[model samples]
Target: MTIAPSRSPAPSGATWQRADWASSFRNVGTELADVAVTASRGTIPAELCGSLYRNGPGRLERGGQWVHHPFDGDGMITALRFEGGEARLSNRFVRTEGWQAEESAGRFVYRGVFGTQKPGGALANAFDLRLKNIANTHVVRLGDQLLALWEAAEPHALDPHSLETRGLSRLDGVLKPGEAFSAHPRFDPGHRGAPRMVTFGVKSGPRSTIRLMEFATADDPAAGVQAGQLLAERHDTMAGFAFLHDFAITPNWAVFLQNAMAFNPLPYVLGQKGAAQCLASKPGEIGRFFLVPRPGSAAAERHAKPLEVPAPEGFVFHHLNAFEDEATGELVLDSIFYADFPSIGPGDDFRSVDFEAIPEGQLKRCRIDLERAATDPAGAVSSDWLEQRCCEFATVHPARQGREARFAWMAVTEQERGNAPLQAIEKLDLSSGERRVWCAGARSFVSEPVMVPRAGTGSEAASGPEDDGWLLCVVWNGARCASDLVILNAHDLSEQAVLELPLAIPHGLHGSWVAA
Candidate 1:
């Protein structure tokens, strides 16, 4: 699910802007059939031969009734393919059982996790335990499967080239019926050959159960993955119920930070609030982290004996990257953290959220000392602010996934300070204190940066020089009510190209770059 800030009690600042932003809030129901995009600005890089795939909520409403929250919307697959100095675009909705049923009925027939209730309210929603398999969170290519994933349910497979739904995938039976697979999986860059994917799923209850998985494929010399295969699997149980979205993985460890948010199903059971809306962060509680040894590693025994540490996990939704410092032996994990749980109220609408009341995520770097954590919890770790500006969805070069990299990219608010809509992209230097930003005009909305290394620069020496390629991101053009794929030179954050589309794609959550 998307961790968007809840609606603030106060209204947006007085001098209200025009409602033209409603265009972006509208659903882009159009499914363009591989439309060739002509560059509106600079030329497309000739060496850029790959497809940039993005996933997020597309169809936000049914039968003229808006969803209680954007997370209730249906997942849309957007593909931007580049080859021989040209780009082609195609989009389609993930036709899951829930999406198809709602489309056929022309109204909401299921209760949403956030707050959308049945039209008949209490009577229509009470005693209903069915959850919609809305595969709107993320998209990933595992082996030959291009899966549209939702953390709570099995992934829906789709055709990579045509964005066609191919039914729910079972990962070759790796996942049983109704089994969950997390959407946010970490890529182990330090793996010998091909990068190993590390992901986890949770079954929360009195004795919460967590399963960790590892997958890999043969490293293609050309950087194109042929197929993925599962390598390892491990399951362990925790003490209490927990909420988890993303995790950080090192060479030998996978770290999960469990938030202190409590879920009271009383309201949900009584058909008053949705499941997600009933979660509230407990006061005066410092969350903890569960560090398990990664599967297929020398320290595999440590998987059953996870190291525990007190952390300000508060409500961390995403981990940018993590790795162990060779000299210090300290595990450094950088994450996007918020001050409190991003709560969803029953009547809240994210689009109408008050900027003043929302707490923005700041980039934080935490240093973990296992030996110290074993003796005293307080001295086990130390955290320092890396960048204070409100930021989220920070990404780095793919080669630097499990290592300390010099550069990081993120979507940030346009203003110099305070929280607002994301209208700019920032490049932060991890080693030095320098920062660079590329602002997408005042009215444009930019998504996460997908860094694609230039062709022929696949060698370690070439990628070591950070920013040797291009950054691809989607920017919503408010004036034209369309979207543009803006390509920026990673080195200096200069605009390289802009490919505009005829229709606007709703702001999305996560995206990936798969080489052709």
Candidate 2:
């Protein structure tokens, strides 16, 4: 089914400007408890019942000092609950140890990983290698616990209902203190049996080590089994510094791309620049794809070593999905690739960043022949462009994860090309290369779109069309000076409802949908 490219028209008399986009970064100071929200445009779906949780850097300044980057700001979580054709909103800040300490002192005592330094000069900030757990990247509900995750440190647990902080969690002792747990996790729909969650952590250095872990879900059919019980764990060490943020997985293999980038921590150690700003791409360097076998797969016993295949020149922060083609014996990976690493310099203001100056993420498809990889590794991999437009934060139906999928929903730029703020939600048909977009307006901006399948359509007992669902997205209403929860029909990019939010949520990094 081919869907021709089309876009929803902007609101009458609405004009887009840099200031309109910048207004979304303002700090939301107050927290609300169960505030009812009303739809301003359409009626809410009666069948849609669940909670949408989002996390991001909410507070940008403290003690009259602004963070050098938005990523350095404090983490805030927003919960939007829908039930019986009604919705209520609530938000709270995760009270990490660092957040509590700074609140009591009423000053900047910790240096941020993204270049927010204390009042004292370089002497005071120098050589302090302690990393404060910001807990600002992503949120996930595993079994009975809700965890706010940061890639650099342990996740902070919170009450799934009240949004209250429950302190740091060690995954029931699966993790130790101060260990790195990744923010991005892939949910496998269980090709073999019960579903499982797959995640990884990295300890990067001259020789980087990656620890891959899998956990059983609370929805397992087994009686009296606890959620988050570690199912499998494996550690692998590879050459070179690894700055991996996300990875892709199939039924049998976990795939990671090691970008050809060099990191120099001298400037960061001297308190002159952020740690991320110290990385630069290596010219003429080709990336590599590390394919590791899963714990209980057919390839696990025979291939105890990870196979490395040459990758195309680019950097990937996120992958859409991956699947193994049974007929061709090839593993297919779909990912968004940037020409280079995007960084904020010491003097650059994130609010005023030039979108055109940085590289845009374009989606690409790569196919690796497993049989050929065992012999001629260099020539086993091949790739081509899938979507050459400016887009990010893409997702497929939960049931189609790590499997062949035909549809994807993501936030995209309003224009056909070039880099800009994401202003619309796009539904792309991967089979036919067609797309449909629903734009809020010229001045409005958008966050990631989460696709929630309609109940009983696709589940363990049955299967349905991949696009039979709803797309929930948080949109910044620049004209209203607030935010809105925009809901669209997954079958077609049509507005189903728009719940006006009293408070504006800062542009978030990631979110998840939990069915009640």
Candidate 3:
């Protein structure tokens, strides 16, 4: 973990300009201000003070209709709820402004926030959850009931504490129009306690399935206005399956990553507008990895079957999760993407629009073995990508096992760059592949790493209640756009405590802590 470079001086900015097609790009912004003052854990502010939501993208209208991008939050905070220690956020006060985005047409999207232990008091008692379009994924509370799923071109169900809607389901035979519904409506929480919903569809055309629906909530909302049985089916794969992102489930098993038609991305955003006739019949994202099993009976269908993982003829594996390791029944499968960097050049725009030459991606650990993947769930156990440097945002800190199953992620190497800078925050000792970086450059864009367990210290015969894990995180500091919260020391993330958050929280994507 060697990060030394700090001659400082380069944080000025018009957001660090450089986009009109890269113009020869090279603004590592003073090694990203010495990797945010060495992964900042204390004083590091200057100007960039946080907050930047804007949500508006996905469009096509003009009568062709494709819209769908609403989630507005113009006031700020788009969705953050850390619970107990307090963090509840949801800004954008009811704005929608139609959708036709040429690039985020009207902006202002927030979509969620619902805390209650009295942190800042009434923001309508916290529980807004917007989205007249887009906003699909991660609202799910189930157990006190709070859930949402929308695609706008029709497919709704909101009411995470009164974001109110409760029913719409018109996939008109099942999804079409520019397709966009990546499933995150998951919740199995056990049999009679009731809670099960899983949706995944991203088909722009022929054959691309993964639909599993089942909502429950009936006590007679007028004989049925919302909840209970939509049961929608569809899942019989292998035919060059089309796009199907992130997935992970375990009440038996249900994993996904299908992508063949070149792992489609809407033909590279319609080939960046020139609409190259369909980019030679599309195949522009490169994909592979499909494993499904989990329906019931026969020992849970022999522990869920259906497997096919094969890639390494050009690389392409993004996000995917499932980490069940009950005394080695083994299922660990984390992921990450962006490849090609044999020294960068293809399309070169300064290593492809500054994503910094890709490669610096890897952290694959597989060992499925569910009764030999139930007869070849892709031939069970074996894979790699175990860290070669240049990583980005990895996470797996649910705290488990005989300790030592922690991972923190967020690296940069080559002495940090700018506008994206993240320099260090490692920690992966998984069985002994050893790694440790406990902070190196303050606020370089962190956001995901919430463990926070530390209470009694576990083991009083183990039933569930003995703490020792703290990690929490927020980082950011994009030249002071502000952000800090840190808390480290989950068995030594280098013992820390930063805090400092009064406001300035605009860059968000994945978050959830709940341990109040």
Q: Point to the candidate with the largest TM-score.
A: 2
Q: Per-residue lDDT tens digits of candidate 1, residues 1-516?
A: 111221111234422233434567777768986899988988999889999999988988888788888888889999999999998999999999988998899999999898888788888888887889889898887777788989988899999888999999888888988888898987775455567777888888767778998877444646554456677888887776778889988777888888877888888888888888888887898778888877766557544577778896557998889888888878888988888876557766677777768778889999998767667867788999888888888998887887778889888875656777777788888887688878777557788888888776663425446788988999887767888899988888888888888767888888998888
* Evaluation by lDDT, superior candidate among 1 and 3: 1
Error of 2 at 482 (Å): 1.4
Q: Write the per-residue lDDT of candidate 3 for residues 1-516, one digit (tens) a residue.
A: 422232122343412322321221111111010011222334222221222121111121222221111122111113333433333333221122222231253332222211111122234223432323434323343333333333333434433322334444343344554345553444443432333555555443465555544455333355453444444344544655454445655545566655444333343232221111122223354445666655552334453436656533233334434656778776666655444322222123222345443354555655566556646654565667666555554554433311224444444332323224343456555555666655434324554454545443432214443224555566554444555556565554654546544334433334334332
Report how far off residue 325 is in candidate 2 (Å): 1.0
Q: What is the C-alpha lDDT of each candidate?
A: 0.81, 0.87, 0.40
- TM-score of candidate 2 on Cα atoms, chains taken together: 0.96
Model 1 scores worst on lDDT over the 10 consecutive residues at 1-10
lDDT of 1: 0.81
Q: Please give the range of 10 consecutive residues that has the lowest summed lDDT in model 3.
A: 25-34
